[model samples]
Target: MKRKVVIAGGTGFIGQYFNDRLAKSGYEVHIISRLNNHIMWKDHHGIVAALDGADMLINLAGKSVNCRYTDKNKDEILKSRTETTKILSTAMLACENPPPLWINASTATIYRHAEDRPMTEAGGELGEGFSVDVGKAWEQAFFNFKLEGTRRVALRMAIVLGSGGGAIEPYQNMVRFGLGGKQGSGKQMFSWIHIEDLYRIVLFMRDHENLSGIFNASAPVPVSNSDMMASMRRAMNRKAGLPAAKWMLQMGAAALGTETELILKSRWVVPERLEQAGFKFQYETLDQALAEIVKS
Candidate 1:
C-alpha cells in the first residue's frame, strides 16, 4: 500500500518540488488549495475527507511575504498562516484516524537578528516586530492543539535557494542585470539551503519516528550578504555590480513594491537538530548552491 500525503497550499515553488519528489517516491500526494477544483478550503468536509487515513499532513499554506508589508498585506500575511493552520488543526482533531505526523511551516525569522552567532532550535533567542511576531503566532497555532496520537513538527526554514522560484532567482536576475551587489552594509548573514536538501530533510523527518518539535531547515554554513552577492556575480559571469546602500535599497524597494527588510535582515541560522540527527546536505556552501542554480 502506498503512503498518502496531504499538502495544504502545495502549489507554490516549494510545494511543486515536494509534489514531484513525493510522487516519485510512490507516496500519493494531494494538494489542498483554493486554486484546485478538487479540494477547496471552504469545504471543511472535503478537507477532512482528503486528510482522512493519510499517513502525513504538511501545511505550507500562507500568503507570500515578498511584497511591501502594508496594513492590508500585513493582516493577510498573518491571517493566512494562522487561519489555514487553524482549519487544518480543527479538521485533524475531528478525524478518527488523523495523520500520524503533521508538519507545519515556520520561519527562521522567529529568531532575533544576529550577526554574532547562528540561532538554533535549543539556544536561539526570539525576536519581536512584525515578521517575528508572525512566525511566533504561526508556531503557536500549530502547537496549541493537542492531538494525542499525532506527532507535530514546525519547519523553521531559512531562505531557500532554488533554480526558478525562490529568492535566488531574483538575485540571479539582478546579477545578470548588473545590480547584484551587496545590500546595505553587506555584513548581515544569509543562511540558506538547496531545494533538494530541503526535500530530503522533509523525508528524514517523515521517516524518523521520534523527531518532533521545531527543526531549523538551513545549510550548516552561513555566508555574509557581500560574499553571497559576490558568489552570485561569479556564478552568473558578471564582474561588476552596483552596490545598494540602505537608503538606496529603501527607495528601490518602494519603487519595486517590495520590502527592504527582506534584504537587510541578518538571519544567521543553523540546523543543529538535523545535524545531530545525521542528515547531510548535498549543497553545503553558497557558492556550490549558486553554481547549480545558475546552471539549471
Candidate 2:
C-alpha cells in the first residue's frame, strides 16, 4: 500500500512544492486547507477532519511573519500559528488512528540575537522580541499537547530561497535595478535554506521516526548581510550601491505594522541537529543557491 500523507497548508507556496514532491515519491497525498478550491487535491476538509488516518501530517498553516507587526497584525500572526496548532492537536487526539509523525513548522527567530556566536539547537538563548515570543508560544502549544500515538517534530526554519515570491525576488529586483545594498549596518547574519532542501528535509523527518525534537532547518553556511548583498549583486551583474538606513526601514515597515527589527535583527543560526543526522545541503553556498534560483 502506498503511504498516505496529509498536508494542512498544502495549497500555499511551500506546501504546494512539498505536495508535488511527495506525489512524485509515490505517496498518496491529501491536502487540507480552509479554502475549498485547491488544484493539488480534490479531497478537502476542515481542520477537524484533516487529521484522520494518515502516516504523516505536515503543518504549514500560518500567516506570513514578514508583514508589519502592528497590534492587529501581531494578533493575526499569533492566532494564525497558535490556533492552527491547537486545532491540529485536538483533531489528532480525536482521530481513531492518528498519524505516526506530526511535523510542525517553526522559525529560527526563536534564538536570541548573537552577533559573535552561531546558534545551535543544543545551546542557544531565546530572543526577547515579539516575533520570538510568538515563535515560543507556537512551539509550546504543540509541545504541550499529548497525542497518544503521534511523534512530533518542530522545524525551526530559516528564510527560504526559491524562484517564486519571497524576500529573494524583491532583493533580486533591487540588485538588477542597481539599487541593491545591505540594509542597516550590514553586520547582521542571515541564515537561509533552499526550497528543494527544505522539501526534502521534511520528507526525511517524516520517514525517520527517531527524529523528534527541534531541528533547525537551515543551510550549514550562514552569511553576513553584507556578504549576501554582494553575492546578490554578483548574481545580477550590477554595481549599484543603494543601502537603506535603519530609520528608512523603520519608516517603510511601519506602514505594514512591523518594525525595523524584522530587517535589522541578527539570527546567526546553524542546523546543528540536522547535520548530526547526516543531512547534506544541496546548496551550501549562497552563490550556488542564487544562481540556480535565478536561472529557474
Candidate 3:
C-alpha cells in the first residue's frame, strides 16, 4: 500500500507546496484545515482513521508571525501554534496506530543574535524577545505531546522566499517601482531559504528516519540586508539608493503592534545540522535565489 500523509494546516503556503511534493512522490496527501467548515475534531478523527496504516504527519498550521505583536496579536500567535499542535497531537495519540514520523514547523528566530557569527543547530543561542518567547512556547507545546510511536522533527525555518506570498512579492513589487531599499542599517543579517529547497527539505525529513531533532532550514550562505536588497534590485534591474531609517520603521511598525526589531535585528543563522546531515541547497546565494524567484 502507498504511504498516507496528513497535514494539519496543509492549505497554507508552505503546506500547499509540501503536499504537492509528497503527492508527486507517491504519498497519498490529505489536508486538515478550518476551511470548508472542517472542525478540528472531525478532521482529526477522519485523519486518524486514514492514518491507521499511514506514513507521516506534518503540522504547519499557525498564524503568520510577521504582524505586530500586540497583546491580541500575541495571543493569536501563541494560540494558533499551541492549539493546533495540541489538537493534532491529541488526535495522533488517540489513534490506534499513529504514523511513524511527525514533522512540526519551527522558526530560526528562536536563535539569539550572533553579531557576525552564524548560528548552528548544535550550540546556537536563542533570541530574547516577544517572537523568541512565542517560538519557545510553540516548540514546548510540541515537545510536551505524548506520541508513543511517532518520531518528531522540528524544522527551524528562516525567511521563506517565493513568488506570490512571503517576503519576496512585496519587496519585489517595491523594488520594481523604485521604492525598495535596505531596512535600518542594512548590516543586519538576513538568513533565508528558497521555497523549492524548503519543500525538498521537508520531503527529505520525511524519508530520513534518523533525522529527528531541530534542523535549521536555511540557505548555507547568510547575507546582509544591504546585499539582499541589492540582489533584489539587480534581479528587478533597478538601482539601490537610500536605506529605511530605524525611526521610520519603528513608527510604521508601531501601528501594526510590532517594533523595528523585526527588520533591524540581526540573525546570522546557518543550516549546520542540515548540511551535516548531507542535505543540499538548490540556491545557496542570494542573487541566484532572487534571480530564480523573479524569473518564475
Q: Which ten residues in a row have the lowest lDDT in candidate 1?
A: 34-43
Give all TM-scores, in the order shown.
0.97, 0.92, 0.93
Ranking of all predicted structures according to lDDT, beginning with the best and ending with the worst: 1, 2, 3
- Across residues 210-256, which tens digit of lDDT does each residue of candidate 3 receive? 88878898999989988888888888888664567888778878765
Query: Which scores greater on TM-score, model 2 or model 3?
Result: 3
Write one digit per residue (lDDT tens) for candidate 1, span 1-296. 78899999998899999999899989999889888555888889888988999999989999999999999999999999999999999899888789999998999989998999889899999988999999999999999877789999899999988887878877877787889899999999998889999989888888899999999999999999999999998888888899989999899899999998899999999999999999989999988888788882
Candidate 1 colliding pairs:
none
The sequence of per-residue lDDT tens digits that candidate 2 reaches over residues 106-126 is: 999999977999999998889
Candidate 3 residues lying further than 4 Å off, grouped into runs, are 37-43, 254-259
Best candidate according to lDDT = 1
Query: Weakest 10 consecutive residues, lDDT, candidate 3?
Result: 37-46
The whole-model lDDT of each prediction reads: 0.91, 0.82, 0.82
Model 1 gets an lDDT of 0.91
Better of 2 and 3 by lDDT: 2
1 or 3, greater by TM-score: 1
Cα miss at 130, model 3 (Å)?
A: 1.1
